[model samples]
Target chain A: MSQGEPGIELDTSLGYMLKAAASALHSAMEAVLSPLGMTITHYSCLELLAQRPGLSNSELARGAFVTRQSMNVLLQSLERQGLVIRPARAPVGRALPTELTDLGRRQLEVASAAVRRVEQNMLADLDTDEQDQMRRLLRTCITSITEPPASTT
Target chain B: MSQGEPGIELDTSLGYMLKAAASALHSAMEAVLSPLGMTITHYSCLELLAQRPGLSNSELARGAFVTRQSMNVLLQSLERQGLVIRPARAPVGRALPTELTDLGRRQLEVASAAVRRVEQNMLADLDTDEQDQMRRLLRTCITSITEPPASTT
Candidate 1:
């Protein structure tokens, strides 16, 4: 029972449920991905490159939902590991476009398959219509929160 | 455009959409809570105690979706700040049931209102029926991922 003021009705709060669902998914991903020595952000960067081929560090940071500083550190590590490549000097401006190396692509194959299985399991109970509905609803929530609040100033 | 194998369909993947929604909500909450000098988990721990008083550190960790060691450190910090209390020694077992102080309750009032606003913003576009649908869909996802990988030899 909620005692008094300052109480969030966690049982019915959609945000709370969203967090719970995300936390569960995170745990499941870690369970599989950790064995590969890859973090969610690591796999995310590789996946972004696999799709986009020449994403900038800022772009990858945005896609991975991490800070640019952290993304830079990861990019450097990945580069040192021969999993990704970037020109020593920016081809244009100060942005160095990054792409996955062949080694990175090969590594992604195994990790990506493992991740796909987790996603599949997460949707195992939802039918086609339900899954589509979920995507639409989740996008709505994302937009609603991410949008700038109506000018109260 | 997706290059080839190992690339996740970012636009259509329900899992990706879920992460996007959760990330937006997280940013919104942090925007508000940080000004209140609380992290999401810090607010979450106090909120949990507000709703369910006398929860052990481990129980709080599970509810907050953090490791017990991390929760223990947070609990110690909260105790030092006079926001929460635990017996010097366990009243029964190794578990220390945690309770909020009056100061904690006061602190939660401000943070809880901010969090509620964020949650409401996230659901602003959804009517009651659609909100319920999102809840049901998310719960299904949580269960699917959290349950064991159906008895592989």
Candidate 2:
């Protein structure tokens, strides 16, 4: 019945499946994170800061897949909560580099382990080779969409 | 320097790559759909209705991977815009069965095609076998996470 239209076949569409997988992972992460009073974006910000310290607000937003304004709001909340801190003035440029407080790292240590367990559970059924294959396919798809159109490139 | 923690390695983590792929596809879809005045969730709701004419608000919420409250808000807006219709009273159960208007179908035709293009672009580099592999891999991951943990199952 749907053959006449160009609508995506939800059962077979790679995009839909990708979304479902991502959404499942997100919900699982949230399940683990929420008990500790963290949202995915909030946990993401702290994790990013842990791995790459002194990242600016804009960079953190990009890394967290959020807008700069939303990241700024989160930063302010985190600051008030003493989870993160930014200097009163930019030492080098207009961007204020953000850092995690001692409390932040302690919180992140717990949250990170929970998140890792969720990821591990998600991959529990798959073997190493299959995990690698999934990773490759996902990376290929990301490159296809993120890179410039073929005509321009 | 960072060997002590369980924090996910952003570069090698399958879950992180899954998120990146989904986010890229989401951005690509938004780029196309926004020009036609649609958000992904907005488009998802219409598309779900087109494919399943009698889906209830809760069912639509499940299909679209959004909370019931968010789906309720979207439905109200869609109803006000004359894109969808529900009976003044429930026809059968407490759930209100929703169906799209002719206008909604017409709008969906255009947005569906645009979304299809975005999906195609994302899969441009993959062969049929690779696409099938990705579908299998994604389905497996979804199942692993969504099914009861092995102890309970």
Candidate 3:
């Protein structure tokens, strides 16, 4: 086949850069969280529950960018570790709503502080205006990617 | 323990927003690439090889944000499929360098175009200046996360 258009120039590709930034952020978060005996996904699950208590397993999976099965496994481990709890049965549906336990909340406190510092460090160089602009820009990109693709015909 | 500082406000946290954007972009890429029979990591491996031929397994894993073991598994699969090749023995060090075969390059062409379209869609609303700003912003964040932690004393 005809040589495909020159492959995306990695240096200038926004998508590549986005992945790089995300990867770096993930590694940094892991470095801090691991010492606290938590993984990034574990921390995310607790944080999501704190902000929006009783999120279902599937919801946490979506929020954490992991498969439902993986989240289910994590939830099980968290439950065993006494970090979160779920009713023996779903109160209203098949989705068992989850919440942080006292132990979980206590654990989250230290991890949250560490995580906040990581985030603050990440944005230490950007001013408030620039941070806002970055937020808006990121939201725009997210919308474009998530929205239905336009007619190509 | 004393109540830790309030957890990061999910809505306003740049780090959270960055993860959201990256997640969205990844899902979008997967949607398009899957029909082409490529997972996001698979596509990333091919793309990286095309851009920087002879990347070692560990390097590819780092670039793809996967563990070295995972990358090794994928490399074995790709090698079996005749899409990539490595010498029977390392030329010098123990790192066996990988190169894409002609078939691999052709496959990458299609995947690259699909990925580029996804990236373009993500940036459809941003002007050149805004895109440049985003690039700069992402680079700065990546650097901050990767660089050694500043002295806390």
Inter-residue clash pairs, candidate 1: none
With a 3 Å backbone cut-off (N, CA, C), the pairs that clash in candidate 2 are: none
The C-alpha RMSD in Å for every predicted model, in order, reads: 3.0, 3.7, 4.7
Worst 10 residues of 1 chain A by lDDT: A1-10
Cα lDDT of model 2 by residue, B1-102, tens digit:
223444457878888788888988999888888888999999999998888788999999998999989999999999999999999899787899999999
Writing each residue's lDDT as its tens digit, candidate 3 over B19-50 gives: 99999998888888989999999999998898
The models' CA-based lDDT, in order, is 0.89, 0.89, 0.89
Candidate 1 chain B lowest-lDDT run of ten = B1-10
Q: Is candidate 1 or candidate 2 better by TM-score?
A: 1
Query: Which segments of candidate 1 are over 4 A away from where they belong?
Result: A1-8, A151-153, B1-4, B151-153
What DockQ was computed for model 2? 0.55
Tens digits of per-residue lDDT, candidate 3, A1-153, equal 112435458868999999999999999998899988899999999998888888999999998889999999999999999999999999897999998999999999999999988998888888999999999999999899888778461
TM-score of 1: 0.95
- In order of DockQ, best first, we have 1, 2, 3
Q: Each candidate's fnat, in order?
A: 0.83, 0.81, 0.73
